[model samples]
Target: MSNPVLEIKNLHVWYRTYGGYSRVLDGVNLHVYKGEKVGLVGEAGCGKTTTMRSVLRILPEGQAHIPEGQILYHGNDILKMKPRELQQVRTRGISMIFQEPAAALNPVFTVGTQMFDVIKYSGLSKEESRKDNIKRLAIQAIKEVYIPDPERILNCYPNQLSGGMKQRICIAMAIVTARELLIADEPGTSLDVTIQDQVHRLLRGLVEKKEMSLIMITHSLGVARELTDRIYVMYAGNIVEVARTSDLFANPLHPYTLGLLSSVPKLTGGGVAEGIYGRIPDYLRPPGGCRFHPRCPRAVQRCREEKPLLRDLGDGHQVACFQV
Candidate 1:
């Protein structure tokens, strides 16, 4: 097995609101190895983004807190890092590709101005007419993402470019830094199918060529299959299953995972895809035992009263379901 570049162990997170604290993640455990592509897939509000933000220690300052757990990158705990060290970790270790490029990119600035600012802060262009070197690197990164007209792209504002183009710009910004890990949080949100496919292909190729680890946060099982080596199926703030992508797809162990795979729409004509019934449980007062038991068709008495630990079945496949 590859060395673990990032390890999240028994993670428990909570968000403070006016009403009370909402338990967002309950003893969640995830680890990504060097040069590995891992996928986190679940419905909205399932703590996918929370896990990524926690690693960066960039959670809403006073609104979120990690009551328990550890996030270690390269053997250093990010939660305990001083601000200066944390800043170094972000710039030199991890890069993030956000869901919406419009919000991620500065609306007031042109692409050239924004990318130049990043290159400046990166300390990569310190000598010999910084502006010229920054522009050259920015153009090269843009070209790497398969953008045909790098000069035209740099002159345009976020609003002037299409959704696909803006997303590509986001990828360019992320790749130019040469960080060790890239966390893509719904990187294909607003694009059409063809464009989304292009984005996924671009990300896969870039990660491989850069030899960087990737944490892909997505909803589509198809995208997960295409990009990830391993998959984690999350439901109600907990991981229900973890396995190799092909193994999980061929023989999904958890009921929640099976339900998720069934929910995907098919191109061929058929009856509507069946969705898991009931809404995500209230986080403030989540169900007592297993979070997925309420929606799982195979739930038993033990499933409702006792929580299941993620136990390895074989060949590194692990699941937290009593029935499995």
Candidate 2:
């Protein structure tokens, strides 16, 4: 396999509060090869978004601290990059589609204004930065997302557009600037079911067409199965399992992963879906050893005293639990 477009190694993040620091991400390790779509699946507050935000170095500086980690973008460490280098990365190397479309766009600016600004600053050459050229590129990008009447849509404000339309516009902006990796933090959120499907399909098509690596953070296991090549199952700030999407679904290893898969409602109408027994552990005072030990049915004394590192189980499947 070729080198990964993005790699995160031994990442640990914390948030400072009156009650000391909260451990948000603990020893997270992940990678995305070129053109491969990877899924990060976990319940809310599992540090999925924190991991992505750390990749972009977008975490709030005063509140968030990274005591250990390396975020490598094509072999370069993003955490140590200078401002100019970081700016270049933000403009051309990677882009993120935030969860809320309405919050991402500025209500004060017209869609064209925002789109043109993004295109202009997206590492464009002096000759390509002209107003006319930027407008043309913006229109072309909007067209790619299957939005109709690009010109008219561009002229409208974000408030005037529907939720789906705003999301497509956000997608257009992301693709226009993102040359290597696109981090989508729940792009289909807050939309109708039908529109959500359309957005997911559009994202998959765009990633394939552009040959860009993707990290799709979604709560829906069904969406993860449908869209990603590989899946990483997270639990309370740690990655409990990693495997090919098909393998993870067919034979989940970690106890947490099993719970997640079992909780999903079956379309074929099996009785009530089984829910995970316990809620996520509190970050300020998380369980000592394996974070999921408190909720795991098969947990032993070892699981309660010593944290388990991810162990390879052949064929690139890995789980961080002793019983597995």
Candidate 3:
């Protein structure tokens, strides 16, 4: 196989709080092949957002620290890249579509102004960067997500548009740069079911059309299963399972993965799926050994005393569970 478009190895990130440092991402291992869609799925506060932020190098100033692991892009270490190199990566290589479009856009400026700034910031020439190109690109992006009348929409302020419309605009801006990798942090979170499906399809279309790899973070298992070729199940910042979508769903080894799959609402007469009992452990002082042991139905004594390393079980499927 060709080299992966992006790779992350044992990424450990922490946030310094008034009380203590909270381990937000602990040894997260993930990768995205060129033109592949990889899903990062987990409950809220499970470090899904933090992992995306780490890749973008947009962690709040002086708040989060990378204590361990390496993030590689085209075989280069992202953690070691200089400021200029990282900027190039952020602009020419990778772009992000944040979850909240309202928060992502500038309330003070028109959409056109903001988009022009983004395009110029990515190193476009002022002379070559015509207003028509900016407007056309923006409209095309908005139209790709099935938004109505992209021309009029581009002229409006972010606050003037609906939440779903704003999200499409965010996606448009991210992909309009023609970056090789797109990090979508809950791109469909706020939209209704019909609109969500439209946006989801639009995202997949964008990745396929541009041959760009996508790292989509979401809590929706259905979304992950439908869009991503590979799925990573994260719990309290730890990646417990990594497998192809079909293989993981057909034969999930880790108890956490099983619990997550079981919770997905099914269409058959099985009624509403049951949720995993217990809450996510506080990151300030998470559980020792296996973090999921407390909630794992099949957890044994080994799970409480020793943390399991991710062991490949052939065919590229991996799991971190002593019982498995």
Query: Per-residue alpha-carbon lDDT of model 2 for 166-255, expressed as tens digits?
Result: 999999999985589999999997899999999999999999999998999998899999999999989889998999999998898788
**How would you order the candidates by lDDT, starting with the best?**
2, 1, 3
lDDT (CA) per prediction: 0.90, 0.93, 0.87
lDDT of 3 by residue, 29-127 (tens): 998988888999899999999998888788897988899989999999988999999998988899988887889999988887787777767766677
**Distance from true location, Cα of 150 in model 3, Å:** 2.8
lDDT of 3 at 212: 92
Clashes in predicted model 3: 0
lDDT winner between 1 and 2, please give it.
2
List runs of model 2 lying over 4 Å from the truth. Answer: none
Positional deviation of 224 in candidate 2, in angstroms?
A: 0.4
What are the clashing pairs of model 3? Answer: none
What does the lDDT come to for candidate 1?
0.90
The superposed Cα distance between candidate 2 and the true structure at residue 252, in angstroms, equals: 1.1
Using lDDT, give the best candidate's number.
2
What is the Cα-based TM-score of model 3? Answer: 0.95
